[model samples]
Target: MVIVKDERMSRKRTYLMCPPERFTVAYAINPWMDTSAPVDVELALKQWQLLRETLARLGHTVHVLPAQDGLPDMVYAANGAFTVDGTAFGARFRYPQRTAEAAAHRAFYEEQGTWAYVEPTEINEGEGDFAYLPDAYGGMILAGYGFRTEAVAHSHAQEALGRPAISLQLVDPRFYHLDVALAALDDGNIAYYPGAFSAGSQRILAQLFPDALLADEADALAFGLNLVSDGRNVVLNAEATGLAAKLTAAGYTPVLVELSELKKGGGSVKCCVAELRP
Candidate 1:
């Protein structure tokens, strides 16, 4: 007797590219700055440009999207939407102040027709609270359910993606998103700020990936541990001395990047951009 295997199950996933014009969008927030502190506008713009270049250097097609009139923090594009499988799922920001970002995201995806799409009903912000980790058993996407993405919304994302979802608890206000604390390495091992990950989340991570690296509290708060890797090479903040050495010993080469401007705005390199379609 001959047996038939399912061809659909064996197919590989496809990746999409966004041109430079649609990559980043910025909104000036001069008035929002604390007068007590100095505003490094020049430095901020330089770091922002560096973030764009970093994504491009990773071989992603960048698209610098247009910004809305009043949203100053909008330059950190990850807060806008989540895109996967050539489809864009717009977000409904939990904070009322950020609700306007949805409009920009909707407009961008609308122009790109013939793509699968999902419009969020429940409150579900994008990259700020979620990260997709690539692995051999398909891929896993983690959704933080406390600050911005609700538990119910995470369920919706799981259903939408047709893959398993790991729900993470973002108990700390400072770590409003998972990406703010966690980054997945090339080998499916995760590097995260120990203080930022909840006890429950840590248990889950340990169970799923026994080799996960727990970063130091000082380095984590300083955003020294956050990194991006091209599934082979990892780029990190230069100040992550301890973590960098550890990664090197682990057989991964770490490229250090300077991002002083992002620190001024409570953001590191990871928060400033999303590795879209990679």
Candidate 2:
């Protein structure tokens, strides 16, 4: 396999994260969530801390968001907003359970004074459904719908970010969020689970990313595709051996992290990470 080199791989990244102080699986939204099961908050906190530390160790700046007491899913900061060039398109959650989160996130963005928050006219789940592709792909935004985010929100995001948007419809209930089924890596590469997307969406992805790496069912089940990349390195679930091997072969270093406790909340690495672009 020939490896493509991206010169902008060394670009520094800024990430926003909330502590898992109020994290828990009290309700079930996606298929991965099971409210009946108990969550280990201690382990969740430890895992989240390790993830934050990992980002810091990788030379990325990590910004902390104060965790509000009633918002259990606030730790999934990626759902807060889709930010680009310091402009934030606030998320409007589809489910009532998460609706309150939108306001809290908007408040945070406004208080930061760093981002110009834009109220979205439609329902969008922030970075959970909208991923920023590399410059190789013309710095396009990959938007997902069919679960949490609405397709119409793509145009709003495009307008806010001043970038083109490609809408991908998710088909599998388990992969409710696009971040769980796909990752936009550096070097114009993408890794995803095809089974999670609709037939038409899969066709679109195939045509657009002919050389995209495919994750097997086992890896997909482990949320292997839910990853964050800094061009040269990818941080993802530790149990996804198949995807790790594939990433390594593609000339990318894979940084495996454990988030089993956090998985009970239907999230992994990317879920807790919100990229701050400028």
Candidate 3:
């Protein structure tokens, strides 16, 4: 059943205790898999399984969905599910290649009967490019409109979620998703690679979060800012030294993990796992 909780009363925090009933994932089969990239299907399978076990170990219920053909590189499922107000809205994608992806994921969410789908003429890809930050002053959502998402999409999402979301346009092509350059820490802190964000957007972020830690290019490329929060804690890529130090200084322990292989697919912690916290 779907529950609509007031964002104001939820006191939503970055860190979360893993929810037991929600631990499954869906990944796209890498169509670019070739000898050069050497898409080891076995390795990919193993990685997905390991990720499932990791989340399971942390007290989550896990499920894994197979990647469909023709939608290679469609492994980013978080973009398909927009969770807010206890209702998950499956989104329609802007890219034609992702149309099937959005449809399939939307069907799945509807099957659960706990989510509502937001259908829009403009492309509205999900969380890969957007993040919902629930803080004390109310839930502030930061949206990144880059290569994968557009401003129109963000507006549609805001209307569907019934919440205010700050729209940030990402000008850089390399950093196609906001998660690629920024992360929300459990300690009410933000870790970001400023270069990936536009100067104006960076300034706004600074104003909103004056104590945010700046991550460098090396770390940014290494998925340094793509972190995962377990309600009260976070796990970051091991290479984010500066970020780790800052997070530790802020009174939250950082769990470091080696995700070098996933880096090949242009994803890190955030991309590897999707957290289901209420």
All candidates' TM-scores?
A: 0.81, 0.95, 0.79
Report the poorest 10 consecutive residues by lDDT, candidate 2: 1-10
Instruction: Name the weakest run of 10 consecutive residues (lDDT summed) in model 3.
Output: 14-23
- Model 2 per-residue lDDT at 90: 94
What's the candidate order when arranged by decreasing lDDT? 2, 1, 3
- Highest lDDT: which candidate? 2
Native-vs-model 3 lDDT?
0.61
> Which numbered prediction scores highest in TM-score against the true structure?
2
Tens digits of per-residue lDDT, candidate 1, 1-278, equal 22222210211222222222222224322222243455466666665666667656656556666655655556656667776666566789876656887787677667767446678888987766767765724877877777668888878877876656788887766666777678866535677875676899878877887776677776676565556665545667767778777666665666677766555445566655655452
Residue 224, candidate 2: alpha-carbon lDDT: 90
Global local distance difference test of model 1: 0.63
lDDT of 2 at 269: 93
Stretches of candidate 2 off by over 4 Å are 4-8
